[model samples]
Target: MATAKKKIHYAWWTLVALCIIVGLAKGALNSSAGLFIPGATQELDILTGNLTLYFSISSIVTMIFLPIGGKILAKYDIRSVLIVAIILQAGSFVAFGFSNSVWGWYIFSIPLAVGGVFTTVIVGPVLVNQWFKKKNGMALGIMGAAGGLLGAIAQPIVGHTIANDGWRAGYISLGIAIIIIVVPTVLLLVRKSPQAIGLKPYGADTASAVGSDGAKEELDKGITLAIARKSSAFYSLFLFFLLITSIASFAIHIPSYIQSRGYDVSFAGNAMGAYMIGVLLGALVLGFLVDKIGSRNTVYLAMVLAIIAVLALLLATDSKMVITLATGLFGFTVSNSVGTLAPALTTSLFGSREYSQIYSTASLGLAIAGIIALPAYGYVFDFTGSYTPVLYVILVLLILNIILVTFAFRGKKKLLTQGHWN
Candidate 1:
């Protein structure tokens, strides 16, 4: 038989398209949720503490449904799932415009969060994994940056909308706009995977994936959930996510944080945008580092930067130049909670076969953090009339995160030696 040659496929194009849709939808919703805080509380005549519980509701929904979301994604057609998810998320956003009662937020937050799991949390990584057999970290990083880029655009627009037309209009317009944009792009462009369309993974041809195939590590050995549950490393990594995300959860409060410190809403919004810019920068740089230097070193670098950034935030919160620098630095370190560490660490520990399950199981830490931290910030303000306690807590969490990362790496090394990886 004659040797065969390969041809370029359309799957890479599909991945790029999904990235754009997924990125825009995630960017607009997740990044802009902070903009709604002030108005939701003020208009509904509710305590800020009460209105913020909506976030807890959303987080709970995401945590509960994450595994189901994964199984559904694996079972269904990608295009169909995405369409339903977009409508739920984007449509609920528009419905938020009409909500005069707090119950609306509590109820609809379920669908919105379920949609969020599909679009923002699960889609990018799963889609990338399907389409690109190589450079996956880079692809995911860019997808992560999409929210930052969109946030860069959305934070300012949301600030202006609330300032001009009130928060109602802002929510309605952004919600409808995201649906309009994402639906068409996803429907027309995204394919399920390379294999679904009869092709090899992107970069599989004339790329390092082929050359590196000979010594390919045992890439799909998934420890059962029970076995993984029993590992010390699992708890360590969970704490890593919990603490790190608790720190990053500050992003949602930055708008309120700034206004309390005598900054204008516009300036606060701009600061949020700048913070997201730092997220884009950090996600890209660190992801590249993980690909080059290994996930272990990249994590330590991220943790150290987080420590410096938190200390900076604690000290420089009152100065314009210093506040921006500190918050931006916080953005840099905190995004590893969502952007780099989870997926990287998930693969490192459990491999690919059970990746979504393990990742989702570990993600309850984010929900748990929200349940505890969101209300804690509100109560702290109610008591002390300040965010200083929140800052101190964040610093403590980041320091603990460093210790967790070290243990996770040490555990992975042991797993490899035990032949779980071979």
Candidate 2:
């Protein structure tokens, strides 16, 4: 009798879909926003601070939507939700091109944030958890690295487009491209659960078969949002999100920051490309490190890199190479705030049970950082005439983040001792 051949797993396909969708969502739409600022301000005749407040508006919308977005993801069809989210998110990017005033950005930022809260902030972690029963850290890292690689490509393309055709055309073209690519990927590849295809999650069987009993117990371990809310683990994770994001918020200002230091827009764009390369390498390294060395150690090392990057930026003078290298290192280390770190940290403290709710709730820190940090950086530049202060503040936050990560793990040990994990 002939034997049937084993089929390739669909989880890998789902990962590819996420990589494309999330990568484009972040690289083409979110990161590209920085490139538009100088040109947009000149044409619209708006102050930089005023133009960037749209980020604040977007953040406010994200804060309101994140919890609700979690519920929507749970209750709605994954394909349908993603398709509509792309339209809303990318469509807003296209709409920004037609606007002649800062108010346009302010208004459209709502839909942008509404859609982004799902696509950018929540979907990758949630879907990875539902699909991958092992190598979860590596999977998250790949997702982030994909964003970095795509962002590397998009950054230059966006800069060239703006330089040649203006921000208006750049925005419209990028939005159209994202919708075209992401919609089909979402419809064809993304599934809510492995059960939809009558298969167990990738690596689920091996994870169970090879585990020590302690490992099995930990897999069964988790706490509800109610319990997590009351735990120090949750709060420490929240502050981690907040501080890390506040630090990473500098990316949006990088174009302006470098320009202030005497680099041109084209050079600034190239620096961002370098930054993306850092993101790509850093994401992969951190992912592997999380599995081998653990999240806490990985986090400590990342924070130290962040401080070095900050110091390089602060002290480096007139050397474009030095500034660019510093910026790249900064991007590599700080990108983890939203990239692998959030999800990895979440898993370390909370386990898998009730993950979606806890992750979404913890992500409020992300939204809050967007609200306060982005605009604050912009306004500080507006008033103080330099980004110098911002760099110092980022360095301080990086040090503090190491402490927060330590406290968070300690909190997890308390939960374990208190029977919360049982």
Candidate 3:
């Protein structure tokens, strides 16, 4: 008799679909926004600053919509929510292609950001939490890595398209491509939970076979959102989100810092390439570390690495090679905030009981950081004629995160003791 082939888990399929969908939404659509600015401003005779105000508008909308999006995702069918989200996001990009003035960008940016709240921010972590009982950190890491790699590939293609065919074609083409690719992927592969299909999450059977009740009960193990909101853990996690984001925002000023130190734009570009590579590799390594060690330990390691990177930047200015390496190290550490660490920390501190709601509420800090950090760094450089002060501030914030992570876990202990971790 022929041996029966073992079937792969649907959770893995869900992960694959998420990799493609989120990758394109982030890499192709969101990351490519800056490439169009030169073309849009030159063609439309709009001031670059005025045209970029759409980004601020997008940020504000994202901040306002995040909590609402979290609530919606928790209450609705996952497929339907994601389908509507991609359309709003990609549809806005398509609308940008047809716009003739800066006002058009400002107006459409609202829906664009609204869509992003679901597609890029809330959906991936929430689904992964629902689908995987084991290797959840690795899953988040893979998603983040995929997005980085896809963004790296997409940027060049997008730049080429805009250079050859113009910004309008680039915007419309990429937008339509996202919808075509993502909508079907969601409909076919994504589900609200493994239980929805009468299957357990990946590794859940192993957990059951080891004499535990099952994954469903395991999934339900956590502090409720109301209790979590009242805990020190939640507030510590919130500050972690804000401060880490603020620290990572320094990436925007890196090229200027390089130029200020007498390196040319070419060198700065190469350093940025190194940084991207670090982010890609960092996601994979951090995820694996989270699986092997745990999220808290992984966070501790990341903070230490960040501290080293900052020290290298501050002290190793004489060597071009050192600067490049330090930038890459910095990128590796900071990529944690984007997707990997935030979700892992949430699961570690609060469990999956009300993950979407709690994670999204904590992520208010992310949107707030976006609005404040970039301009704050710019103004610091403008007033002082150097980025040194900003670097020192980042170092301070990095140290603070280590303390916050410690406090967060302590708060979790308190919750467990108080019987709030139901």
Candidate 4:
């Protein structure tokens, strides 16, 4: 019996490469930012509020660059764009190693943010949409899970390195390693679209009639960005992005919060490892739920988890075990909102037409959240000697997100009724 072996789809290969590239960018480089704060502040004699202000600068740059970066990604070769992006981002990290003053961090944060807009913000969702016609939620979830797994490993290692070798060494070593790994991955595996390889996106056969022309027609179906911008769903999605990002930015303060609660840095490192593990599990579960239950219900569930996590954090600070477990829970909720859920929600509400433009424009909230939330947490801690107020604010925001999700779906209904959804 000479049965032919069916070739594996190249989309899976593209997904694998994306997992590595985005995982390293987010897990190793971005997630490690908080770990350096204690060492950088203590050794350099910088104020916590002052040292973290660089994060605001980075956000400002990100806000300015997001729309521009989106356009750039759409126009350029994916590999070339990602290659230059990694160098800018990782190169900035290397520069931070040589910095003895807060000003160095402030200055280099520009390029760091500029590069991050492409690698962290736009690339994963854009590529996933381009490659997977079905199970795109699962693909995004897998990518997020990969980031979480890598972050779980990287967090502890980075913590130990900063503890043993100092923040400078930690920064330079990590930066160099990421650049070495990512450049080749982007060059070899990343492509702009499935059509570039003369193949349809994954599940394209099931999604539409069997022909290139039909697939192309199916892909373009959705509300135009112009009309979408006028809808309530767009505004609600923007607020969701803003509030969720504001909540997630609390991650950068978790280590400092631990230290303030009289825990040692070693314990903080373990907590962060727990957090990443939660993120890994959360991404997988959220992705599955998005596929099965839809994005709105999935988000409702995530918001409930967040409410519990915040309540535990507020009420159970005396127990170290509770703190660790609550932190892991918090990580699970935040990872879903920021990494897995946001893109899924956007796709569900708006469809794929003008997705990159719509997503990037709405992501101004993410940038604005970073600018305000990170430093605000630092300043609150600096002034009040507590993160308790910040926790309360997060609790309120989580409830509001539940409301926003409902409104976003309602707005989508309006669009459908108006025949704006093609």
Q: Looking at candidate 4, what is the lDDT of residue 109? A: 94
RMSD of each: 3.8, 3.3, 5.0, 3.5
lDDT of 4 by residue, 269-366 (tens): 77788788888899888878888999999999999998998898789878889988988898898867887789889999988877878887888888
Model 3 TM-score is 0.72
TM-scores of the models, in the given order? 0.86, 0.87, 0.72, 0.85
TM-score of candidate 4 on Cα atoms, chains taken together: 0.85
Cα lDDT for residue 30, candidate 3 = 79
Give candidate 4 regions above 4 Å deviation.
1-7, 70-80, 126-137, 187-234, 347-361, 407-422
N/CA/C clash count, model 2: 0
Global lDDT of each model? 0.76, 0.87, 0.83, 0.88
TM-score of 1: 0.86
Residue-level error in angstroms, candidate 2, position 258:
1.2
Clashes per model (N, Cα, C within 3 A) = 0, 0, 0, 0
lDDT of 4 at 46: 82
For model 3, the superposed segments whose C-alpha errors exceed 4 Å read 1-4, 7-11, 34-53, 66-84, 94-102, 125-138, 159-235, 251-274, 291-297, 308-327, 346-361, 378-389, 406-422
User: Which ranges of candidate 2 are over 4 A from the true structure?
Assistant: 1-7, 74-77, 134-137, 191-216, 222-236, 346-362, 406-422
Best by lDDT: 4
Residue 363 of model 4 has an lDDT of 81
lDDT of 3 by residue, 1-422 (tens): 23432777888999998898888787668766756665676689876556666767889998788779999999999899999999999999999999999999999999999999999989988989888878786787788788777766665566567657888998899899889989999988888898888988888766557645675788888889999999999999999999998888777567567666876545655565566667778888887787799999999999999999988988888889999899889878986555678888999999988997898799888878877786677667656867789899999999999999999999999999999877
Task: Evaluate model 3: give its lDDT.
Answer: 0.83
